[model samples]
Target: MCASACYEIGCALGDAPTRGTLALMLAGLLWYVGFIVVASILVSFGAVDSTRRPGYRRRDGKQEGTLMWPSLVMTAVVAASFAASHYSLT
Candidate 1:
């Protein structure tokens, strides 16, 4: 989200970011997801201890393992919207 927002803001300021920024953002997101999966697997197998600090929870009792899909979808939507707006402005 921050990545796309930064890109859009840079565009608005007439200092658009290069493709390198997009590549970096993609790499960062992938690294994050990979780390989460590895940590979860280790915790499950008792190789690593898991700790849940006090934090807000959803009203529903359902436990969600990951929000990666929703985040990626939103990022794509924002990027597409920015591209559309950028082209239309030209």
Candidate 2:
């Protein structure tokens, strides 16, 4: 959804330079790859588990792995995309 929105926004920017448009398109592609492909790989590697319920304490009371790294990577991707778009616009 967000990726498509980015692409649409890029397409709608008629006055923007070609580099800006291409940057947005590239950002959209990166969004898809980061969220879908990389996320899937992380899940397969046990880095993430979507089935776990929030605030649900396990019988063993063991703390589960944190999602900090995965989340940081996603955030970095978004930040990089934004930086690319900003630089292209300038």
Best by lDDT: 2
Quote the positional error of residue 75 for candidate 2 in Å: 0.5
lDDT for every model? 0.47, 0.58
lDDT of 1 at 4: 46
Task: Estimate the TM-score of every prediction.
Answer: 0.34, 0.40
lDDT of 2 by residue, 1-90 (tens): 335435544654565568756566555556655666665666675534545665644568754656657767776776675566545532
Best by TM-score: 2
Q: After superposition, how far is residue 1 of candidate 2 from its true place, in Å?
A: 14
Taking the tens digit of each residue's C-alpha lDDT, what string does model 1 give over 1-90?
334444444444443266665555444445445545654654564322223423423457443444445445655755675565446422
User: Which ranges in model 1 have alpha carbons more than 4 Å from their true place?
Assistant: 1-16, 47-90
